[model samples]
Target: MFYDVFVFLVIILTLLILSGLVSASEVSLFSLPSETLERFSKSKIRTHKLIAKILEHPQRLLITILISNNFINVGIALLSTLSALRLSYAININPEYAVSISIIVVTVLVLLF
Candidate 1:
């Protein structure tokens, strides 16, 4: 019973840490300026053109970033669920249920969005 409690605590802690990282990244991404985004948007084009593109469609750029971030978050959640299954035995009760519900929600989100 003690070991199970420990595992549950570990799983909850892991989820919290992951959530913090995701939220931080989302906030940082939203905070980035058009010029800063342009630098990375080019991918391979000239910096000047990238800046121009970003300036022209800032909202589109932000939307794209949001979409990408959502996809990444879904991927991370799914991977975490797999990790939980591998690390903990029979992850289908209590804390494991939390992970299961989260996985299902993420899956639904990925499919719906």
Candidate 2:
């Protein structure tokens, strides 16, 4: 039980980190100036080429990022609920309320930072 909870916690943290990175990257990509994008599209560098391709379809890229972020947030909430339930069981508490509280707290923390 302890090992299971530990694994879940680790997965939750990983998801949180991934969520942050994806959100940051989306913001960074959208904030780039049109001149910079044009330069990237005309550059000879391999990385620049790849970035240009990604930015070519701006709407598609934005939709993909938004969807992925939503899924990651949902995963985090589910894992947090599971972890709370496990902890509540170990301490002989009610899991029903714990799950709701944990989900709300996790959502708030994720949004705040």
Task: Give the alpha carbon lDDT tens digit for every residue of 8-109 in model 1.
Answer: 546655554555565665566567776666666665667656555655765886676567656566555656565555544554456576668668765664
Model 1 earns a TM-score of: 0.44
Q: Residue 32 in candidate 1 has what lDDT?
A: 70
Clashing pairs in 1: none
Alpha carbon lDDT at 101, candidate 1: 68
1-113: candidate 2 lDDT, tens digit per residue: 77778999899889889999999999889998989989998999989888889999999999999999999988988888888999889888899888989978897868953
Angstrom error of the Cα, residue 49, model 1: value is 2.2
Top lDDT prediction, candidate number: 2
Task: Give the alpha-carbon lDDT of every model.
Answer: 0.59, 0.88
Query: Candidate 1 vs. truth: CA RMSD?
Result: 8.4
Each prediction's TM-score against the native? Answer: 0.44, 0.92
